[model samples]
Target: MYRILCVASVMLAATTATGGTLDEVKTRGALNCGVNTGLVGFASKDAAGVWQGFDVGLCRAVAAAVLGDPNAVNFIETTAATRYRVLNAGEADLLARNTTWSFTTDVDLKVDFAGINYYDGQGFMVPKALGLSSARELDGRKICVQEDTTSAMNVAEYFKRYEMTYEAIPVAGTAEAQSLYLEGACEVYSSDASQLAAIRATFAAPADHVLLEDIISKEPLGPVVRHGDDDWADLVRWVLNALIAAEELGVNSANVDELKAQGTSTPEVNRLLGLEGLMGEMLGLDADWAVRAIKAGGNYGELFAKNIGETTPIGLSRGLNLQWTEGGLLYSPPFR
Candidate 1:
């Protein structure tokens, strides 16, 4: 009865929200997050059927901030073609999949991107035996790519600019493409460089394939929520910013509690940790919202290091994803 009343109160609060998805989420007792269709290091189930990866961290963090429970998330696997449709149809509350933030996807599709979570570029992969040193060398090779994605359009643009012709094989998802690529059915597999690396790591002979050094297109990947949900959007956006900001503030799971307990003198640290500001109240969350989110899976840097960092199987260097102080593009707005 206590649990039922708590959920009812949450639903009552959600009714006043800018979007109905929050109400639905509170009613269901979990956040429905759309994720990639098993893209290994980004979003994939483990041996125990637990969803784990970088993007999964985003979903769990958002759930923690809103519902106060990191595990209160139902991850729904979505395909490239069907991702936005699924979000628009209300099958998912948040699209935490590795979706490129494009003007068309944001404006025309009637969805708003919270922010760019991962700065990436489209690239290609080929067997080392192919001896393809550059993407330009694969003019006649058949390329495997997921359908209805920036990858396919980028492939077309790259080929057209070079005046090259190649066979484009559109697959339904990454698993099939990986299967075909491993079986030598497709000479090239193209996607975001991060994804290509992740997929390559999953290959039986990881050393047999190589990702081309040439990046063909800029892909600012991030989470997406439906348009016009100002309240929901602000909460989601700030939760992401909180993670990024916490990293910049030198706060992590290891030190956050200590920082909160000792009362940091830094104004931003106090504001972020809910000891000295009303930022969380502005977003309909408690003062400890940021703390909950950061503790859910550490700060942004920690999650990156754990999931797809240079030390991981993916071995991706934080080129553009590094903090601004470190000469990268990651910068969060002020907490106040």
Candidate 2:
């Protein structure tokens, strides 16, 4: 009766199951990473057609860890709607897109989030001339929201709770939302705060637009992989943890070689760098995996500062993304 009653759910899980992603990726000679179609600061191609961004850094790090070559990655473009389809079909070994880990996707859809790489929040961007100080003031206005994302539902719930109404201008992706917003088709564009900052930075006259001081919903964005693959998930999870731990332990790309060559007094750093334990062998990778990963994209803070920090065009600060030592949410587990 159990099998009969839950046959549909079982079948769904079976279809999406990808258990041997590590072996598959190794056999294929490259890591197939799913990324956003075009989110400038998170994932986008540069002028020479090289993928570079915060999320792309994760992909490269994973590639370096698993395949021993950072450049051995094929970035498959996926939209908000088709990201899961591509991942489940086994076309992408991992997804480093800026996806929010929600209950529905986690429990119901059976997606596994490796870890939270970014702590984001829902926000609204409006023209500076609008002079809107809060999202509460946008009653009955047209708001551009990307379809098939948490932003849509969050915006709806927020307006309903505040007893306000607005016409939602649904868009398929960030580019469309940005275009419609710039064309004045909508008074406001609702999205993640990081994305809003990224989009605003790309505008010709960035000062013309301003993000409201409102952060309506918590969005813990992270890397995602399919369920039923604990081995692959652990590898990915530890790679992320290694980066975060590197940041906390002061093992950066600049000093990784020296640390690995001469060794460290910190036992956790030794274990993390594969100098004191069989951590990498346990993951079916060589001992130098974490070192290669950190070298590929530096530590977590380095990736952030390089891709989207205050100096970059995206100009994102390490608000909640700082290390746990500094009272932020980024705390990696002990390498031992």
List lDDT for all candidates, in order: 0.90, 0.93
For residues 47-138, write the lDDT of model 2, one tens digit per residue: 99999999999999999999999999999999999999898887898899878999987887777999999999999999999988999899
Colliding pairs, model 2: none
lDDT per residue (tens digit) for residues 59-137 in model 1:
9999998889999999988888889899988899999988888878888899989987899999999999988899889
What TM-score would candidate 2 get against the native?
Answer: 0.95
Position 64, candidate 2: lDDT? 98
Q: Which portions of model 2 miss their true places by more than 4 Å?
A: 1-19
TM-score list, all predictions: 0.93, 0.95
Model 1 vs. true fold: TM: 0.93
Which residue pairs clash within candidate 1? none
